[model samples]
Target: MPLMHQLWLLVPWAVFALAAGVKFWRLTRPFRRQLAEPSTEQVRASLERRWRADQRELTE
Candidate 1:
């Protein structure tokens, strides 16, 4: 509840959000544009899913 404690909590949370945002930024843009229609949607979805899954596997 103190100002210092609030600052400490907010600092790390802001850092984490910024980091995650930077990482995922523009990740799905190309895919989304190319796959907005029906046929390519499944393929794009698979690619996107695999990408995130691979990142998780690597991190783990």
Candidate 2:
């Protein structure tokens, strides 16, 4: 086979990978923004709230 044929086979795979990466980045972009610089107090409060909610659900 020629070099061009080998290179052409990789084009579809490259396109698929690029599309997947963009989709994943867009989907998680907001979450990443919020977590990029979270404060310790904020993190603790969020975790505590979630834990309390879980405990309540378990008791029900």
Candidate 3:
């Protein structure tokens, strides 16, 4: 009922909102980048390069 109690209750919701926003941004980033690119071939090449870089990083 007090202002402090109300603010305390909102802490969890605020944390959840921030986490969800970050997750949504990360999930959409690849699709958004692909859409902005001019050609499918370019997109494919870029994704392949990224995959290779990930593989190399893992091997190291």
lDDT of each: 0.86, 0.97, 0.94
Cα error of candidate 2 at position 51, Å: 17
lDDT of 2: 0.97
By lDDT, the candidates rank as 2, 3, 1
- Against the true structure, what is every candidate's RMSD? 14.8, 5.5, 10.5
Tens digit of per-residue lDDT, candidate 2, span 1-60: 999999999999999999999999999999999779789998899999999999999999
Instruction: Give the lDDT of residue 24 in candidate 1.
Output: 79
Q: Per-residue alpha-carbon lDDT of model 3 for 1-60, expressed as tens digits?
A: 999999999999999999999999999999998778478798799899999999999999
Model 2 / residue 14 / CA error / Å: 0.7
Off by over 4 Å in 3: 37-60
For candidate 1, write residues 1-60 as lDDT tens digits.
899887898888899999889777678678878767667788799899999999999999
lDDT of 1 at 23: 72
The parts of candidate 1 lying over 4 Å away from their true place are: 32-60
TM agreement with the true structure for every prediction: 0.40, 0.58, 0.58
In lDDT terms, which candidate is top?
2
* Alpha-carbon shift of residue 42 in model 2 (angstroms): 6.5
